[model samples]
Target: MKYYQKALYDEMTSFYLITCDDEGDKLGRIRSLIGGLVRKARQVIGQEGDDKVRIHQLLQLFYGDWGFHCDPEHYFEAENLYLAYVLETHSGMPVSLGALLLYLADSLKLPLYPVNFPTQLILRAEVDNEVAFIDPWNGHYLSQAHLQKLYEGAFGFGAEISSEELERADVNTLLNRFRQLAKNALIRENRNDAAYRYIASLLRYHPEDPYEIRDRGLVLAQMGCYQAAAEDLQYFVDQCPQDPTSFLLTAQLAELKDHFSELH
Candidate 1:
């Protein structure tokens, strides 16, 4: 079972949460596969000098040898977040694949890191006094001009990208992005039960998130978990007490409380 860590959203743990059930019945197999992959990666870099650790080598290993690539068919499917699915099938959306690749890079002591790009995940590392960026989804170099083109392509001509958008993202941002991917997929498929679980996971890592608190409460109520719904709504109301939406949420929480009391 993935012992729920309420502190920070860990990469491996988050993968476990998405891919496996709470019991994680299949986690052992997943871990074994990951161990073997890392071992192979380690062997691939055996006794090589730091300069030899180039992005193309990584591309060859992950894409050519390991065969990891984007799942174009199910680009945003919630199942792509499952690490086991990615390992076995070698396909996922950018964030999942990027996150896993970044994690593996870190494990191997590579300087690779995740970057913040609008609606897309990317990787970057400092090499020889210059920063190198890679698009994990396709293993292509991500230059500034390319990033601008990608931005405008995804978000019309008026939308532009700058240094602000290219900053390196932290763990919390990665967690939110990961949760958002699954949350969006679940909500799209009308899987409120699973969506609520992901919302709960988001709150664990970011308890002060007012939007998530409000959304989670709404989802909880939809799933007939009245008490939890009320608590989450109340938390949201407390966090953003000045927000006009909180007043409406307050009324809803009051109604939910009354319903909960009668059921006791």
Candidate 2:
């Protein structure tokens, strides 16, 4: 099932009891809040009528109070700030704030799309099919060039990356981001347990990724699970014959009599 479907189902179930008892009042309040928040957001953007402003301007109004902190890791902090602002400034419900923003923008015929970026909760707006990324915390609009520079600094300039790579980041990407976080924590603390959790998460998200399979094999080998490591390495080699690491691991496994030669 799609992630949003599951989320909608859960939401409906939670409010089912309230709806049953006071359907009219419940819906009326929801509509009122949505209408009010939409008007407020539009006013903040200095937009008259339905004319759309840049995505960055929307973000800036959303988080204008917070000073400049552009790091991706500060996403949760930004979310919290927005939540507090909604409650204090607009008398909005916390449970519906994110949904309201998404819905209201659509209602206003805006081009906003929810972005599940790596280690961040953000939104994007498309104009002429080109996406402009929005940071909800400081309300900064991040350009494609900005994203490219950020990736180059982190992953090296030779790394080939594009906005298309970020266009449809789904549950798998979320799992990978969480796994990366766990791996970073492991590196900082030198904890085997943390590393194991990351490996497990990576496998769960991409059971068929050859690189992940090889990584799991390496972890197993380190844990002295030679038999299991051999099996994984054998599978990796079977799936990707061109990988040198897989071939080397397969040869090592063969010496231990755990390699299945026919598989390769």
Candidate 3:
């Protein structure tokens, strides 16, 4: 299997990798690592119910040596390493390292969740039962105010947000991330056809999202297929009437259609 395909399959079957020995000897090692970690965590926490401390330690044990960055690709590679280690050494499989940490945290009754950053991987921890962002790779704790600053730096003004609003992201969101990476790979390889196919798959998974529609339309436009672009942009406009870009695309399409009509 291709690397990404194997990664996807590993994500899907992560839960069983701990026990399924027929897959490979690596599974046994992963199981042992996870088991050892869990035991150590329980001993350290020792029924004190200090979930946050326990989770922090567990994650540290897994990835404290790694550096921190705001880049999504860096986080992806980190997650891949963490998950692969857990899967091959501890009989642990998490959909991703982020998911694995979330799972382990959950098991420890820690209120930890994945943060859906626009282009980064982050986690939120309920320290003292209050929400806070954490840089798992670097052990940097982010305050709500800091998060707002980060958001402004990344997304800009008028982005509606609140600490309470940033709920736990799900597995599907992580899967979409993988798909985004796949799309990027296609682009890097100059395989627009494959890139378009990946975008179609993304739309299938997130049909109601106008952003995907707009993105797909932009890709179609780049390919010089104005008709297809118009179709997608029209849908995007229909779905997100307030987005100025969609309106602009619609106007561009109208002008193209008129020019084509004149020629015909």
Candidate 4:
């Protein structure tokens, strides 16, 4: 495997292993699953040298035969962010699906790379030295116009999809984006303990991130750990004293202190 691919795989697997105990066995199963996918792709993809043809065949195997697609109704569910659950259910949000699709494309020797597109995860494909976009939610190809429409839809119609925005996401960038989505999903569902664990798992990558510290504090507060929450919020306030949200968190910090005193 190339260095970039190996690094990405390691980061993805390690992130998942944070939650589960049976690491080796689970990794083995995931490898077996990828192997099965590769075998199936070979059977259908044939000896095609054309990148586009191979991409199409791989898409057929994945979305058509494997039934992997986004479940819009349950898009925000925490299960949609994990690879194991995504593989089993064949349904995931764009980030999870895009990561798996990117890995599959690489295994099949297709020139697919992750695009950390705003509000949507996508893939950038290079075929015959020409760059194009593919929506990992479905196999549909994306034109620049379509990309503009998506950007406008997400951020309102004025700003365009900049060249920088279409640049390929590096391993850490991709992993962090996916992790953030998973954490947000957990928080939205009021799964405070799970959110806390998820944040702890990701903290190693960004030990001193004030945003994460503040979020962890909020999650702790939700779980009734007022003292810990107070400490965290205080850290955030200290780190970012001028931030607008710091004012609100300062108020919350007082309440947490009050609660801590009551419990004491």
Off by over 4 Å in 4: 1-10, 21-25, 46-48
List candidate 3 stretches off by more than 4 Å: 1-49, 66-100, 103-110, 117-121, 127-130, 151-161, 166-191, 205-211, 224-226, 238-241, 251-264
Candidate maximizing lDDT: 4
RMSD of each: 5.5, 10.9, 8.8, 2.5
Q: Write candidate 3's Cα lDDT for 1-264 as tens digits.
A: 211212333442342342233455565565565566556656655545566666666666656432222234443332243344534433221235555555456546666766666645577776775776776444467776776777787778756566444666655665566555544544554556645765776567578777777767767766767677778778888888887776677777797566546656
* Candidate 2 lDDT over residue span 1-264, tens digit each: 323312321232233322133433444454465466567766665444433354455555545532223334432222222222343443222122333445555545566655555435455666776666765444457777776676677678876556566674464453344344434444344444435555665567578887677666666666666677777778888888887776577667775454334334
Pull out the clashing pairs in model 3: 18-91, 29-89, 29-90, 30-88, 30-89, 30-90, 30-91, 31-90, 31-91
Name every residue pair that clashes in candidate 2. 59-139
- Reference-based lDDT, each prediction: 0.73, 0.51, 0.57, 0.79
Please, what are the lDDT tens digits per residue for candidate 4 over residues 179-216? 77767777888888768877887677789999899989
In terms of lDDT, the poorest run of 10 residues in model 1 is 1-10
Misplaced by over 4 Å in model 2 are: 1-58, 61-123, 127-131, 135-139, 144-189, 201-209, 221-227, 244-264
The TM-score between candidate 3 and the true structure equals 0.53
TM-score of each: 0.76, 0.42, 0.53, 0.89
What is the lDDT for 201 in model 1?
69
- Candidate 1 per-residue C-alpha lDDT over 1-264 given as tens digits, one digit per residue, 9 for 90 to 100: 321222122554564664345677767777887778778877886535673365567668888887888877889787777777787888987877776666567666566767768768887876676788888888878788888888998899868887766766765766666666666677776678778766776678778888898888887887788999998889888889999999898789888998999999
